[model samples]
Target: MKTWILPALGTLVCWGFWAFIPKLTTRYISPMSAMVYESMGAMVIGAIVLAVLHFRPDVSGKGIFLALATGMLGMAGGLCFLFAVRSGKVSVVAMFTSLSPLITIALGYLLLNETITLKEGLGILTAFIAIYLFSAS
Candidate 1:
């Protein structure tokens, strides 16, 4: 058994909590606002970790641009997810969004010429099935 199993289980629990976050966010605030808050919280935590390690922070122009671009993409995705959850069943939206790994795999294949193993291919297919089953109801 992998020693990482406990951490993986903890992550799954956290992910479960995150699934309902869109609904709660859409109820009380704009998705963009929620994403901004989320990003800020992430940044603060990262900064704190670095500080505790006595690491010097680098705010180069390239780093700033990359961070801004990532934040923009995150905000866009969050808004769309919030809209989906508000307009449809949360379980359906969550299941559909779980297919994001497929997007990542596709991008890696296109940009890096990466090859998918049979197991990964099967996982993608199963994700599709899960999406279809969740959305059909």
Candidate 2:
């Protein structure tokens, strides 16, 4: 019932499914082709959202820049994931890739001065250890 819980849970399930679908898709097409189709799907979803907003978004300079950056990162990550899943174990790749938040945490701490508690630091340490152990197999 918390404000973030629903979206957090939704993300978990959506990404859980998203992780599986790309592996299946990369089987039939190259990463570039898969990315093209994926972008098209995203564009269609964006169009619907724009229609719902009556085609007038906030259009702020900062918001636009961040949105563009997010799209660029998402596209690049998707392309990499597609190429990786084709040649590597999907589970292992997913495990390793999911640790990307460690970068976010470090950036947040350095750039935004977001303090990391001892608990979160331990979690991050554990994640890196797990990644090392998991990949060493």
Candidate 3:
């Protein structure tokens, strides 16, 4: 539990800020441009941190390809989110997107062979309920 707690907290913090980033970016730049800038910023920061730590960054072909692919997917997701927030009600878009964890969980199960215990299954169900309630317009 101790091992998981900090990572979970960090992820929550990252996601909390990430969720608002699209809304903020839409104010200044086009969604695609905003995403590009965000990805570039992330890369720069990551490189700086590695340099500071005297750690060599992974530059293998597979790693580079995977990172680039992930960045593209993230940018696409951000663009879609920006469009959703701009064209529809923010609350509705947010509430619907909040259900994204369900997709992650499903993918984990399918691709990673991760098992969902009873408690986790219940939590997922609760999350779905909350999403449904919040998304109801």
In candidate 1, the residue pairs with backbone N, CA or C atoms under 3 Å apart (3 or more residues apart, or in different chains) clash, namely none
Model 3 misplacement above 4 A: 53-55, 59-64
Error of 1 at 127 (Å): 1.4
Off-target runs (Cα >4 Å) in candidate 1 are 1-11, 53-55, 58-67
Leading candidate by lDDT: 2
Compared to the true structure, candidate 3 yields what TM-score? Answer: 0.76
Per-residue alpha-carbon lDDT of candidate 1 for residues 1-137, written as tens digits (9 for 90 to 100):
89999999997898777778778777887776777787787789788989987896667999989988987786678668877887677888888887887888999999999999999899888888877887888
How does each model score on TM-score?
A: 0.73, 0.95, 0.76
User: CA lDDT of each candidate?
Assistant: 0.82, 0.92, 0.80
How much is 72 displaced in model 3, in angstroms?
Answer: 2.3
* Candidate 1 weakest lDDT stretch, 10 residues: 30-39
Tens digits of per-residue lDDT for model 2 on 90-114?
Answer: 8899999999899999999999999
Clashing pairs in 3: none
- Report the error of model 1 at residue 74, Å: 1.8
